[model samples]
Target: LDVPCKVVITAPEGEDPHPRFGKVEMSHAKHRNVSCVSCHHMFDGCGDFQKCADCHIDRDDRSYERGFYKAWHSESEISCRGCHKAMKAKNEQTGPIGCLQGCHEAAQK
Candidate 1:
C-alpha cells in the first residue's frame, strides 16, 4: 500500500525584499477574493507593482505627479490592497478609475 502526503506551501511575508517593513500588522483575512494572477503578467507579477504611474497623469509626453505612497500610507506597513480598501469605504464610491472598485481599494489604507 502507498500513502500520499500533502505539503502546504505558504508564500513568504510580503512578495520579496519589500517585506512588511515593520509599520503595521499584516491582515490575513483580507484580500481573499484577489488572485496572484490578477495583478501579475507574463513578465512581472504582483510583486513588481509600483505606484508611480498610479497617481500621475501623462499629457503630450509630459507626466505630472501628484501624491505619493509616502503620503498615502504615512509610513505604515499595510499591503497595497489593505490601504485601497479603506479609501474606498471612506469615499463610498466605485468605478473604473475610482479608488474603491479595484485592487488599489483593497490595499493598505
Candidate 2:
C-alpha cells in the first residue's frame, strides 16, 4: 500500500467543526514499523481504506462508547492517544502524552 506520509484527523461530523485541539496529524511514515491494521483496525487487507468517521460517528443515536469521540480517545491501542500511553507505560520513547500535548494540544485561536 502506498501510504501517505501524514494523515490529519479532524473531528467527526455533528461535532465541533473547529475543534479546540484542531486536527491530529498522524505520521504514517514513522509508523511504517507498525502493522497498518494497528491503526486501521477495520481495514481488510484487500478492501478500500476508510475514514474513521465512516463507522465511528458522533450521532446521538448510539452510546458514546460507539461514538467518534471514544474512537479517538478510548484507552485502547486502536486509538492514537491510547497507543501512545501504552508505549509510555512500557518505557518506550513516545511522543507527547499530556492533555495539553499529544493529539489534544489546544489549537491556535
Candidate 3:
C-alpha cells in the first residue's frame, strides 16, 4: 500500500468537533524512516487504516487516555509532539515543539 506523501492534519471532528488551530501539512517523507505503526498504533497490520478521530475524541466523558488533545500532545513518544521532543533531546533533526513554530504556523518546510 502507498503511504500518503503529505497529509493535512487537523483535529478529528468527533461528535463535538472542538475548537482547534489551523490544519498542518505533514510530509510523510519527512518521517520516511519511522514505522507506520509508530503513529497508526491502532492498526492491526490488516484492513484499512483507521482515522485517529475514530477513537480519540473530544466528548465530555472522554478520559485523558482517549482524549484527542492527549493523542497529539501526550508525554508518550508516539505522539507528534512527543516524537519531536525525543528527536530534539538527542540533537537529531526534528520539527518545532511550540505553538507558533510548527503546527500552528502558516506553513512548514
Candidate 2, 17-83: lDDT as tens digits: 5545687777777787888788889887896789888988665543477687777777888877688
lDDT of 2 at 94: 79
The TM-scores of all predictions, comma-separated, are 0.22, 0.81, 0.81
Give the alpha carbon lDDT tens digit for every residue of 1-109 in model 3: 7677998767555343234456777898988899999999988889888777777766454348677777777768888888999999999999878866877675332
- Model 2, residue pairs in steric clash: none
The alpha-carbon RMSD values of the candidates against the true structure, listed in the order shown, are: 13.2, 2.6, 3.3
- Per-model CA lDDT versus the true structure: 0.33, 0.74, 0.76
What ordering of candidates by TM-score runs from best to worst?
3, 2, 1
What shift in Å separates residue 32 of candidate 3 from its native position after superposition? 0.4
**Compared with the true structure, what per-residue lDDT tens digits does model 1 show for residues 5-30?**
32111223443322332132223234
Order of candidates by lDDT, top first? Answer: 3, 2, 1
Q: Give the C-alpha miss distance for residue 54 in model 1, angstroms.
A: 21
**Which portions of model 2 miss their true places by more than 4 Å?**
13-19, 59-63
How many clashes in each candidate? Answer: 13, 0, 0
